[model samples]
Target: LIADEYIKMSDGTYPVLFVANKGRNVLLGREAVMRKEKMQTNQIVKDDELFERLRALRRKLAQEQGVPPFVVFSDETLREMSGKVPLT
Candidate 1:
């Protein structure tokens, strides 16, 4: 079972308890279960490559239209498109 909050102790620590069959039990501390979620996973694209290509295209279009790049499209919009990888 997953829990949202932990039981705190006197020494500024938290406890995790497991109760088992026939009154068998185990206890672990907060340090044992706590871990940082991996943010830079292999599945995510390298933003620099995608963003650089997008910015270059935007700059070229802006120059042709005689306007600033933001007039064509914002970086955030381009980043969202990169994230979605939409075809056509």
Candidate 2:
């Protein structure tokens, strides 16, 4: 793990357990925060409006690219995007 500091033993082995600060809004990126929430709860709540909008965008992109909507954005990705309600 890349860190600000680590120690080397006499045997020249470097090993340490590190955990990204949990639930600290300043510590994790938006996706990482939401993903951690999902992992803990086993479910993620999605915003319906964002979900529909993303679906429409994905459908359009898929048609233009001649691929399936899931190829443009999988269901899991859509769900996460919905949770974030990203405008872009």
For candidate 2, the lDDT comes to 0.65
Instruction: Quantify all predictions' global Cα lDDT against the true fold.
Output: 0.64, 0.65
lDDT of 1 at 18: 42
Task: Pull out the clashing pairs in model 1.
Answer: none
Candidate 1 per-residue lDDT over residues 17-86, each given as its tens digit: 5443222222443233446797974444447678779989999999999999999999777877677765
TM-score of 2: 0.48
Q: Which 10 residues in a row give candidate 2 its minimum summed lDDT?
A: 1-10
For candidate 2, list the clashing residue pairs, or say none: none
Every model: Cα RMSD to truth? 11.7, 12.1
